[model samples]
Target: MSIKILTILTLLVPTLSAFSQEKMVSVNGVNYHVLTTSLEQRKPSQPVLVFENGMGMGLGNWNTITDSLANDAPVFLYDRQGVEKSEMVYQQPTPQKIAANLKLLLKELKIEPPYILVGHSMGGIYVRAFAGYYPNDIAGLVFVDPADFTETKADWNQIFRTIGVSEKQIDEMLIKRLYTPLKVDSSRYAAWSEGQVLTDLRKTDFAELSSLPIPQVPILFFVGGKLEVPMERRSKDYDHERFFEVKNSSNMLRWRRFIHASSKGGALIYLSNSGHFVHRDDAAIVIGNIRMMLKAMEK
Candidate 1:
């Protein structure tokens, strides 16, 4: 199962605080919590930085990164339905639907595009869906250890097999690893429920967009290193050291392919000190690359 991402919007502004003045944007009766810096408005042509959160995460996850991005460009951050102050209705939404809702929210807020989308984890997939659905609106993309939806199960199986891991071992590791805190809270939390549904139906719901060619935009990927199961979480079902090696190599290869396939190809920065949350682990790197993308788009 895979989770989708949350959305954020940025503008040319000063530093931001965690608890800033947030607007409750109403789109089709469901209210969304939108947190944006109060900066002098720029022209519509200037690309705004839109940050999306990983699966089962909220806009707060970006606090460290977004705070440093101050005064560079506009940043937009918002909670999707069922998260934070945002209200969720009963229906389950696909990535396209979530993107559509995001589009509507931007419109309601009067924020114009030529957007530089920054997505972490599952948010990467949502941003990709947005680019696929509204290609013209995107100016660039920054993926922070995004979920690899393009890879097939067979591909991973081969990776495990090469390390002398049996099929049963692979299955056990996956089952255990997939049982995250989000899964535990899904029955009680609306956000977790939506996240679970999105993850479960990711292949089916994201099939169309994922099948589309990679968007021809200035793209950047912030891939992490140090892929290992935590000591407390490690089990005898799989070899933790081997899994770490395979995960790191496999993800790097995939991201490289993505960068090469992009029309206006971008750079792939690997942070050895970082884990899955690259932005959180190495804030300086993420901020610098985002600045680079913004400057490139300006040209």
Candidate 2:
């Protein structure tokens, strides 16, 4: 059989017995649970689009936008190490390694490439790493209020230290509070929480991350205007500016730098009404921008 036929059969046959559900793929000792949807009802000639969630969020976070995008292209969303159904290994979760695992997952699933990656927050870091390592494989990039690692690390360290919390403990607590559902059994939460702790300990340096070569893929940046600061602090004249300045100082701004650093043209969109969870705050706007980006990429 032709490779295309085989690929379709592999995907369709699995859903015949039971409703097509989440599937797990193991690469380099770690397992990732991926949620996939295709609105064509049959595979299309277009490249697949991959959506990566922010820190403490999971694959389910993409549910609102995925359906709309799937109408135009195959959409795949997956949990990162220890976030959802993905298993955590002892290995460090650096950008390079995460990108490697994603590549392996795509190949193993017979998902042909030319990927358009849409990443939110820290997920942008992974997307950048993927584009750097496999430039030819990526067609475009959409960064939605992505976290700046250099800025994040500096601020995060201070916040944790001030609370007298170790980084490991902070990681665990964040995962538990944000990702773990209230109904989850205690045993599963414990296992999941511990895995996240190990994953945090395996972090890579932001400087090493920034030094990687930038890919020539079409890029888009979406910035959130709503700032998450203390109520008392909002009265300060410079609070909001300070908030954005630090954010711009981080990796996203570094990404903006990469855009200017290159000779190619790109796009940027500002979502003034939204917060850090821009997708949740305004799915229609985010989805519309993605559609516009996809169309621009075709040009």
Local distance difference test values of all predictions, in order: 0.74, 0.65
Superposed model 1: Cα runs more than 4 Å off: 1-21, 168-191, 194-198, 201-206
Worst 10 residues of 1 by lDDT: 1-10
> Candidate 2 on 1-299: residue-level lDDT in tens?
11111111124423222222357666665667776766235344466788877765788887777767776667778888777667655444667777877887787777777888988877876777787788788777888887653343445444444545567766775566445644433445523443353344324435655676666766778777777666776634234455454544453555666666545547766677888778778899888877876776566
On the 0 to 100 scale, the lDDT of residue 16 in model 1 is 45
Candidate 2: misplaced stretches above 4 Å? 1-21, 39-45, 149-205, 230-241, 244-255
Model 2 C-alpha RMSD to native: 8.2
TM-score of each: 0.84, 0.69
lDDT string for model 1 (118-232, tens) is 8988788788888888888898888898877566556666778878888897776555544443434544465565566555544353466667667788789888887646688
